[model samples]
Target chain A: MDLLLQLTINGLSMGSIYLLLGISWGLIFAVTRTFHFAHGATFVVAAYSAYFFQQLGFSLILAAVGSVLAAVLFGMAVEGILYRYLRKAFASHLVVFVAAIGTLITVENLIAMGFGTDVKTLEGFPIKVIKIGKVGFNNLHVVMFATAGILFFLLMLYLHRTKTGKALRAVISNPEMAEVIGIDTRKYFLLAFALGSLLVAPAAFLVTIERGATIDLGHWAILYAFMPVIIGGIGSLPGAALAGLIIGLAESIGIWKISSQWQVGIAFVVLVAVMILKPTGLFGFRVYRGKI
Target chain B: MILEVKNLVGGYQNKRVLHGLSFSMGDGEVVGTIGHNGAGKTTLLKSLFGLLPPWEGQILFRSHDITGRKPDSNVKEGIAYMPQGQGLFPDLTVMENLEISCFGLDRKTLKKRSQQVFELFPILEERKRQRAGTLSGGEQRMMSVGLTLMHEPTLMFLDEPSLGLAPRIVQLVMENIIEINRRFKNSILLVEQNFEQVKRVAGKIIVIKLGQIVFSGILDPALDKRELWKYF
Candidate 1:
């Protein structure tokens, strides 16, 4: 019984990571039809960026600053150069999808060539387990959960409260109408990509110390992200968070029933079953553009 | 002149919709643009707003040669277009739609406009928190027009505001138009299909057929539905 409780706590902590990742991906995807296959590379790159800054004897705050600036601009550049030109091609949205995939491949290869395939963890940031009765969680988990909570709260406020946020919502709703109404949809797209990069920063930072950073880290996290996003409903932020928790708890508990090697497969089976029955998932209001 | 389109030509990729279409609007004047279903009424407004590019010709606004500029630039220059076909941000609530239209304005101004929108549309005020996608046809039309009102532009371009609205609601909408004109004294270009609604508030009326001005004069009832159908 104590084991069950311990695993639940462990699950919630891991859920925090995926929750952040899912909401970020869903938010970006909901706004810009650009698949941003380069999204995952941005994650690992941020991890590496922070590590590099740490090696330079910077404080945690400075390291965060380094990763954020690098990630934000990289996101902006991706939207500005690659996606902006693609929008003018006057082709179907599928063209952009393919181009985004190409971008993903190029970024991943570049990272592999530079950083090599090996994962690299930062030197100073180390996890120490904080035991609570029968359940034990690292200080990293508490910090990550707190950070994720703050991010989610801020994101909600931004999307629902502010003016530019309303504009973003409008652009996401109807690109043509937003254009006619004098919204620079291109600018909105750029902002959305930047937001994606910003959201990935914490997730990358969260895992970099314990798990290390690698070119494939982004893809690794995305595998977990997909389940939460699907179950939560693609564009629903709150739904994604809830699903992330559910997935985390399910994966942790499934370890009791099946081999740890089959955890990923078991999650997929659950997701496929839910998708077949409830295609809209928990939040049924997600609006997606073009043929997915 | 507040607006002038001279020798303007524009259209889709292969098909030309507006050919040398020329017109002018004056400050404090209500100009009604009437046309058939495909007479390019919406296209004319779009071209002026720079949604559709003019292949050749000059578009002058207030003695400024405002040609070939983007819509955002034109919007900043005091042009708020209430697009035809009820172009609205569905999935957004009424309040959200208003907030987006009030872009970059301070919170105080937004608050004033929200109250003003309520004054213009009491139902909207009542349902300000409601999603626009769920609005009834009449209400959605109201929301679309209210969106344009947020910018408080000097020149208002209202396209097919009467589209799909019932006669009673249409009459109410017409009263709102007159109310707007009287209050702001802003120049208005009204694109309308219903001649009665057009004639109710329009100071001058111009009719378009097949991308050309078929009639340009004061709107007299002698030119009624039967005559209007000829253009259609």
Candidate 2:
């Protein structure tokens, strides 16, 4: 029972990371209707940017801030430059998706060539284990959960309270009507990209500190990101967060009965089960006709 | 003239819908545009409002040449377009729909405008917390018009305001359109398939067939529905 409790705590902490990734990707997809597969590249860029900044003698806090800034710029540039150009060129959804895939491949390859394929860890974090009864967790786990909770609260507040945030919601709900109402859908699309990128930075930073950064992490990050979104429903942010937690918990618990090597497979099994049973996702109201 | 479209030509890619269409409207006028399904009634509003770029010709709005300007710019310049169907965000609450329509307005103005909307459609206020998608068809139509009211637009392009509603709801919507024109002094270009409803509210009637204006004149109360059938 104690072991189960420990695993649950670990799962929740990991789930928090997945929740951040899922909502980050979900926000961009819901708002822009863009299959932004290159979001994986943005994750790698953020992690590498933090590591690069720290190597240049910046404090850990400054490095994280710098990483977020880099992620925002890179994400916006992907939308403003690549996606915009493809849209102007009259690319179909499939074509744009292919372009995004190509971008992800190119970026991952470039990073691999630049930083080498080997793992590189971020230095100077004094991680300590904390115990609650028989269950134990690191301080980093607490930080991860706190960060995700705070950010999610702030995001919900922004979406509900601010003019720009409402505009983004308007675009997500109905792009054509949003345009008619003068909400500037293009500007909101860029904003979605920026915010989406910003959301992923902490996940990238946390993961780099926990398990070190690697070029291969991009594809894994994106896979986890997409699984939660698809499992939760295409356009529901809260759904994605919940699905992320479910997947994290499922994977963690499954390891007790099977080899830990099958951890990733456990998430896939849950995804398949949800797809077969629900199809629209756990929280999806209907087949996505542009509702956030 | 508040709006003048001179030889406007535009349509979807590789297909022409509005072929050299020309018309003009005075301030605070309610002009009803009647036509068949493919008669380019919606296209005319779309082109003038900048949803679709004009292939040729000019659109002068309040004497300013706004030809080919996007919808956002046209909206900023006091044009409001309520497209066919609900023309609202279904997932958003009725209040949210109203809030987003006049996005950048200050709190005072927003409250004032929202009150004005409530005055126009009091049912909207009662259902403010309800999601717009779940509203009855008539209520959804009312909320659509209410959204346009939030910005206090000088000109409104309302496509098919009475579409797909019961006879009683249709009458109510037509009456609301009349009230909107009367109270707000907004010049309206109303598109409708049902000429009976248009005749009740419109001062002038513009008939289009296959994208060309067949008739543009006063809505004579004595005009026969049979006579209008020939144009269609």
Candidate 3:
């Protein structure tokens, strides 16, 4: 029972990271209707940017801010420069998706060429463990959980309270109606990219601190990012977050009886089960036309 | 003239829907367009509002050559379009929907405009906090019209405001459209299928057939309604 408790605690911390990744990808997909596979590249860029900034003797917090800004610029560039051109060319969804995959591969290759395919770690965060009853977790775990909770709260607040956020919701609900009301759908698409990139920065930074960063982290990051979205539902943000937690918990608990190497496979099993049982995802409604 | 279209030609990607359609409207006049399902009535509104770009045409709004401009630019030029269905966002609250309609307005202006909408449709005010999707069909229609009123537009392109409502609700919606024109003196280009309702509000009527205007004239009250069937 104590061991189960420990795994559950660990799963929650890991789930927070997945939650960040899922919502970042989900928001972009929901608003722009673009399958941005290159979001993985955005994750790697943010992690590397933080590492690069810290090597320049910047404070940890400043390095994080710099990373977020870099991620935002890179994400916006993907939408503003690449995606905008494709859209103007009237590219189909499949074509845009293929372009995104090509971009991910090209960027990953460039990073590998520049930094080599080795693990890189970000330092400065103190490693300390805290014990709660029979369960134990590190300071980083607490930070991850708190950060995800706070950010989620802030995101919901922004969506409900701010004008720009409401405009994004409008686009998500009905792009045609949104345009008819004079909302600049293009501007909102760029904004979705920006915010999506910003949300992933903390996840990248946290993971780099916990397990170090690698050139190939992007591929796995994107896979995990998409797993939650697909398991949750296509257009539901809360659904993605919940699915992230479920996947994290399932993977963590599965390691009790099986090898830890099979942890990744556990997520796939959950995804398949969800797909088979509920094709629209756990929280997905049948007529998911305009609810976010 | 408040608006004029000269030899407008447009459609969706190779399937030409509007073929050399030309018309003009005066300030503060309500013009109704009627047609069969594929007669390009909605296409006309889309082309004029820039949802569908005109392939070859000159759109003159208050004597300005605004051709192929996007919807945002058209909205800034005081043109508002209410799409065919429930134009309001279903997930958003009534107040949120209204807030998004006049997106760039100041808080004071937003408050004033919202107050005006509430006055026009008092039920909207009562249901301001309710989710727009949960509203009855009639209430949703009212909210759709209320959204167009948010920016106090000089020109409105309303596509089928009475599309899926009961008979009594259709009467109420037509009456509201008349009220909107009378109160704002706004030039309205209304596209509707129900000719009986159109006769209640429109001073002029244009009949479209397969993307071309078959008849354009005044809606003479003394004329037999059955005679209009020839154009359809």
Candidate 4:
């Protein structure tokens, strides 16, 4: 029971990380037709950015904000320079996909060169310890879970209630019509990329704060979130989030029953199974012969 | 003149669709422009809205040059366009579509503007939360026009709005167009196929054949010769 409880706490931490990732990936996919396959690079970069800022004796909050701002600006610039030209060209989107892979390689190499390939952890930040019953847990997990909840709530409110959010959805649904209706598609895309990059900042911090930062972690991290986007549903935010938690639960329980080696394989099995069952997944929008 | 297009020539890619087309509309005037399939009526409207890059022509809206701007930029200049097929985002709710057009307006202003728009199409107000894609063709047209009215444009450009609508709905839309011009004092440029429908609202007619304006005058004169029906 204690082991189950501890694993549950661990699952929460992992789930929160994937939740942020799913939201970021979902946002980019929703507003822009192309997926930022290098989205995880922003996460790793934010972790490194947060680390350097902390090394400069900046407060954690300041480091977090700085990382988010830097990532947003970089993401917007990347979309403008690369993704903007790929609009309406699915063939060219393949080129952008290769370019995304290139971005991942470039960022990882830059980080490895600057910060070295060693695992760098943010230390001495006053860790908060909490114990409930016989199970002990870190307060950061609570913070992680809480932050994910808050982020999702705020995102839902913005997407559903605010004017800008409505415009973003309109642009996503029918870009040409949105323009005639006065919603600038370009402006909405910029906002989408910025928000996506911003979501990754905390996920990066969570990863680094828990395990440590390394260049290749982004590629691995992206695969985990990508599963939810695929097996769960594409362009659906809630489906991704729910699937993130499900993945976390499966991995956590699977480790208890089987070897840790097969933990990654569990996602793939679920991916293949869910895909074969209902190709569109939990909350997929029905497409009419690829029209919708 | 509310709108002036001169020597406009453009289309998708290198294929030129419009060849030196020119026309104008005055305030509160409804102008009908007709042509056969591929006659460049839609292209002319798109060029005026800056959707396509014109090979060469200046578009003046309210005496201001707006040739190279984007669709949103044109909306800011008080020229709202409703594309053919009543181009509404089918997945979104009527309220959602309305809000998209009310982008520049603030909350309070948007509230008032929405109410005004709702009055223009009361059916849309009743189905405010319904998805646009599910509405009937006539209702969708109303919603599209309702969405356009949210922009508060002084000039409305409607492209083939009567394409698939029933005769009754077509009349409703035409009446709404006349009412819109009467209520808002907006100049309307209507690209339509239904000749009688166009005749009901349009004060002037311009016939485009293979991208050139073959006639520009009152509708009665253009339709005086029964052979002119081929141009439509």
Using lDDT as the yardstick, the better of models 1 and 3 is: 3
Best by DockQ: 3
Candidate 4 per-residue C-alpha lDDT over A18-98 given as tens digits, one digit per residue, 9 for 90 to 100: 888887887787777766878867777888888898899988888888788877887888788777866644347678888
By summed lDDT, the worst window of 10 consecutive residues in model 4 chain A runs over A283-292
lDDT of 3 by residue, B60-123 (tens): 9999988888998888889999999979898889999999998988989999999999999999
User: iRMS values in order, in angstroms?
Assistant: 3.1, 1.3, 1.0, 2.6
DockQ of each: 0.47, 0.74, 0.79, 0.53
Checking candidate 1 for backbone clashes, the offending pairs are: none
Q: List, residue by residue over B47-116, the lDDT tens digit for candidate 2.
A: 9999988999999998899999988888778899999996999988999998899888888898999999
Q: Over 4 Å off in model 2, which ranges?
A: A289-292
- Cα error, candidate 3, residue B1 (Å): 0.9
Which residue segments of model 4 deviate by more than 4 Å?
A1-8, A85-91, A125-136, A287-292, B89-92, B221-226, B229-232
Residue B85 in candidate 2, Cα distance off native in Å: 0.9
How many angstroms is residue A96 displaced in model 4 relative to the true structure, after the best TM-score fit? 2.1
Off by over 4 Å in 1: A57-61, A174-182, A223-227, A289-292, B13-15, B85-96, B229-232
Ordered by lDDT, highest first, the candidates read 3, 2, 4, 1
Q: What is the TM-score of chain B alone in each candidate?
A: 0.94, 0.98, 0.98, 0.94
